[model samples]
Target chain A: MTQKTDQDYILEVRSGNVNAYAILVTKYKDMMFTLALRMVGNREDAEEIAQDTFVKAYTSLSTFKGTSKFSTWLYRIVYNTSLDYIKKKKRVILSEHIDEIHEASIGTMQDAMSYLEAQEKKETIERALLQLPEEERVLLTLFYFEELSLKEITEIVHISYENVKIKLHRSRKKLYHILKNVVEPIYLSHGSRK
Target chain B: MEAENKKLDQFTKEVIQDAGLSSPSVDFLANVMAEVSKEESLVKAQNPLITKVGWMIIASLFAVFTFVLTRFSLGFSILGDWDLSSLMIEKYEMNVDIPITYAYCFFFLLVFVIIQINFIKKYFYRSLKN
Candidate 1:
């Protein structure tokens, strides 16, 4: 049997088969939670935001005009919900000193150097991602991890295509800066003279 | 410096692409479904049919009261000078008058209708709060 599409589930929901909505919630929950996690930087807040997004989506499902993909519409809700949460928290995670980042294990400048020499590329990248600002992390996640088009991301983030492009470029630079902090030490420790 | 930066940027993009999506708690869908069910129940409880029926009954009783008052010709001065009776008679060409007992009954009915309206409004407002 063919899998039911999001539109099929949506039509069922509109016709009063509320149980069909559970399929949609199950399908999108992980993606929504990941986006929320990238935005809010915590599992608990991410879960709350994802749950709230699904509930809001269900309540407002009637207003969905089918002009866009259902995932896009649902994503817009999750993005706005996560942003509202961040605004309410009033503390942008990016404002912390690089050395004081919660996930950073480098206690001293010496430790940063020593840790960089020993860290794997994957772990280094993960730590570097956490070290960057929330916006950059979200942009990278959407563009690279989620593999969304620049236009789709523009719609979700409510920015112009040009603005998304520029911000994405800037975010790449920021990510590189964070990654370089960890990676450069490994090159020196390998006795590669620059 | 430029070459090193370019390489790091490439590596970062590859790592990001490989990071994969995060998973939520296993019960996430169940929790959402529970909330959706709760909301659906609240909306069902707020169905407007009961209030609509209440208004329809009130309107039918009002029509019957007016018809009886005009047909009986028991005129009362306090019930707006029998204007409703006169209008009905002139429009339909039937003799009628406003009645004192009907006036008292209509006054009490008006009070009851007002109270019913207030109660319905309160019911709606409370349902909205939920």
Candidate 2:
């Protein structure tokens, strides 16, 4: 496979170049995984959903017609796949284990006074992220991690852009609140520097 | 409201930059690529139209089978006994032993032909008529 542009890659894929699809899968897999992981909150399920998304995108490549950007189409598949998997798994209830992790991060942050502090901060953020409502978590993931614009998020999530904007606003507000209140206090109030 | 909007915008950027949501891991990509390859092979093995036609043929066959089964059971009850006087009376008053395979075939074929003709007429000849 000579390195090809996205359009060329799509064309090759449409023309029955099976190997070309590997390029696309490689390109989008991480973004898809993050999207799925945020939606379902489990790495294994997220990985499975990401794989399903790629397979589905390839099978429905003909229907794409290039109407939307390739990433948009890919995200739509990832979003829908994650949603379907969540429905099947019936894991809507946020588990206590997540809360336990969130609480433990606070305890561990007390003695962290150097390079490990940064790692702890990252873990704290991820833990707080798990506390958000499902829709809020998904919206934040798509908008922030996926770098999808509000309009693109609307298309992928199948909601109005105004609705996306409002939901995104509320989600961000909730996320900030969780970080500031739930995680930040724990870190800031940790025992005075040595 | 403007201040609130600015704060939200700032928060959005901060979150996006901090979250670090990149694409899947390298190993995950490998798994997805393998899955796509398998799917591609399956997709290439058959034409879309052929698959649709195949399903239609299968459904038609199933319908024919169910009709045959139903008719055979009905036949046993309607024409079980085999005697000369039974045949004579059945011939006149509709009570006799008939193999029923012929009737079942005739009924099903009639239905199949009618549906095919209707489909062809609607899809092919109707456009010509217009």
Q: Pick the candidate with the highest lDDT.
A: 1
Q: What DockQ does candidate 2 have relative to the true complex?
A: 0.23
Quote the positional error of residue A167 for candidate 2 in Å: 0.6
Q: Per-residue lDDT tens digits of candidate 2, residues B15-59?
A: 555666645555876776677766665545433555777999999
- Tens digits of lDDT, candidate 1, A1-194: 99888999999999999999988988888889988887887899999999999989988999999988898888889889988998999964653332222212222322333444233544566667777777767788888777789998888889899988887767766665565566656755755553
Total clashing pairs in model 2: 6
Clashes of each: 1, 6
lDDT by residue for model 2 over A1-194, one digit each (tens)? 78667778988988878788888877777778877887888887788788888878887888987877898989888888888887887876542221212333333332332223565666666767788766677788777766778888888889898989888877766665566565554545554442
As a whole number from 0 to 100, the lDDT of residue A87 in candidate 2 is: 85
Per-residue alpha-carbon lDDT of model 1 for B61-127, expressed as tens digits?
A: 9999999988987665566645575466467766778899999999999999999998998887667
Error of 2 at B95 (Å): 23
Chain B TM-scores per candidate, in order, are: 0.36, 0.34
DockQ of each: 0.31, 0.23
